[model samples]
Target: MASTVIAVLEVTLSWLFANAKGRDAKSFFTRPALANFPEQSITVTSPDCGASGSKLQVDYTQDGTGRFPALQWSAPIEVAAQVKEWLLVSEDPDAPLPTPIIHGIYTAIPASKTSVNTDDFTVVDQAKALMRGGFHYGRSRNGLPYIPPRPLMNHGPHRYFFIVVAINEELDSELLKAETTREQVAEAIEGKVLGWGMWVGVAERKWE
Candidate 1:
């Protein structure tokens, strides 16, 4: 009974303090490590979520399959030719926290690749993915490679930024493992980032 009461209070407090007008991924880039990276002409799109600034489908969030959505992207000819690898980060700056809540960290993507399907990132199929690629995954806040959006109930809309970074140098393989943290990924890419692009998808929890 005591634990139950505590859980209820925790939920209530979170709901009460939630910001209805939450910030988006652009705010996330203001951090010192990322502030210098130029915004390049990379086109990132998702068929599952329509387009940037569009509402994310339930199928990609905690409400449904919770799979990482399929994504496609292209870098400029010069950038592509120089890029040694690509890094993808998904996070929610609107989350009621001091820092954005990281949803996923997928790195070491081959420079030759331009797209990824759900099969390439669904955590359940990670073993299969390892057999087919040179890419690696970094642990999210929940200790998994991906955590689908799960905004607090009544917290209004939360934007999930799928930020794709083009890196001129290959990230240290040691820092691209399952135990790696977001800070580590940021550190690994600090001066190596050539540029980046982003796609934003919004989700909100209206029901408990």
Candidate 2:
């Protein structure tokens, strides 16, 4: 019985040590920067994307059912003819260490739409139908579909950023057609942006 107790203790210790190490590693990762752009400059708000209702909000916990809230600006920052493409992205600056985690990337939203519904991130409909069919917001790896992965432990309140970028030219029809990496979408939209709007949301998991 003593030997069994010792074995159980060892197992428990091992698990605790591993969890500590993982948390430590996560802490080492630098979180992404909070959105500095002003609210008046843009037209949308999301709870998961900002500190308040007026900003974009990103829920840290992926309930598998909760969708990312969306806000829309009243007008396009640039004319449709000047826009080459549209891009949407979400980043958690608070993510630990090596890199900030990218929660979502969507390319090819048309310039015409004034706003996207929060449910638009996952649902297929007339609004999404207007954009390039392949590149909708909140797509996950392997075309598996997106499900937010809420951290088990809230590292304070993490900021979730949502950006809508209007680019100058259609850069990557090939990759966009093939389903490119989130990084690729970023790369394609770099520098060519005519205008961009952003929102922020805060999330922290509560321990009971």
Candidate 3:
């Protein structure tokens, strides 16, 4: 299972490890520190995103800061008690950390609820919408309805992965209601995952 930050250390940690001035073949970078998954790149598409949606080409930008209200999914939910529409945003793992930061953990959306635009970001309206739609909000690491990505300075660019997963079995909603990490969610949905889609956004603070 995956777990999810780091402080301002250096932008070249991984790079420095790769090309140490004096090291033998058995030294650090030559040896594996952890296991990894096979890479599968996700694509993104928007009106301004043009015709292609490859990895760096699909950038997640802010028209201005404090832009925290929108969602555009490509699929609809199936009507079933066991079927749930789940959303999550996770930080990259390479940064020094004990667990990956969880940006969002929303679940149980109404089958008819497809997206949330800027106009729908109000707390009261969102609550009303969720209540009307029978949705549930889950643990967010930052304790906000939503926290825009703010990767630390010198931590290098972080890949914020926003994913929509179809969970086709009943889950422990109680556990997800409190503090939860990305790995916990991953473990919960392991064999129960019906389908999944993903989008990636890069964020970083310029080092002074």
Candidate 4:
């Protein structure tokens, strides 16, 4: 009987420790610089994400094809004539880590464009192809083209943010290279921001 009680205590303690770390994690949207930056808010939309705050379809998740969905955003208020390029970043702040997970970082989207088709990134030489077609794919947190949403089971719903930033000038060559960190991308675009916007999609994994 005493062994049974000890076993229960050990399991309880381990669960508490794991949950504490997740609760302490911070959202990327709440970062001081982004939260305080002065910019116009554009509208972002995805067919896979029916509406803001809606449940993301399984097709776009790790459980499915894990395809990067088509995305569109409103042009910056300042207009294409003044904007040099745009940056698209997707992340999940509810990840049980110190910083949110960076799903993808795509930059150099031509200022004249406001939408990307679903098949854009599936090319053989995605980076070079994207560059020729008007955008480039930067290395994601996993060093892959994209990371599909895969929240921890029983962690409740996680909010995935698709953030878009309009820039006054092209991003530096260094920032567009492989294996770029979120901090580096954020800092490089700091003073160059002309406007920004975001769309949120929620996903949850239930414990079996």
Instruction: Kindly give the number of clashing pairs for every candidate.
Output: 0, 33, 4, 0
Find the 10 residues in a row with the least total lDDT in model 3: 26-35
Model 3 residue runs over 4 Å out of place are 1-64, 75-84, 118-121, 125-134, 170-184
How would you order the candidates by lDDT, starting with the best?
1, 4, 2, 3
C-alpha lDDT of residue 64 in model 2: 42
Q: Can you write out model 3's per-residue Cα lDDT over 83-120, one digit (the tens) per residue?
A: 45544343343334544555555555544455544333
Model 1 residue 35 CA deviation in Å: 2.8
Which ten residues in a row are the worst by lDDT in model 4?
20-29
Q: Candidate 4 versus the native: TM-score?
A: 0.79
Q: Give candidate 1's whole-model lDDT.
A: 0.76
> What ranges in model 4 sit over 4 Å off?
1-40, 126-133
Relative to the true structure, how large is the alpha-carbon lDDT of every model?
A: 0.76, 0.50, 0.44, 0.70
Model 1 residue runs over 4 Å out of place are 1-11, 20-28, 31-33, 38-40, 123-133
C-alpha lDDT of residue 50 in model 4: 70
Ranking by TM-score: 1, 4, 2, 3
Candidate 3 vs 4: which has more lDDT: 4
| Model 4: per-residue Cα lDDT over 12-120, one tens digit each | 5445544533321354444444655544477888865677778888887897878666678886455555788988888887776767788987888888888776576
Question: Which run of 10 residues does model 2 get worst, by summed lDDT?
Answer: 27-36
Question: What TM-scores do the predictions have?
Answer: 0.84, 0.61, 0.55, 0.79
**Candidate 2: where are CA atoms >4 Å away?**
1-43, 47-61, 74-81, 123-144, 177-179
- Quote the lDDT for 76 in model 1: 81
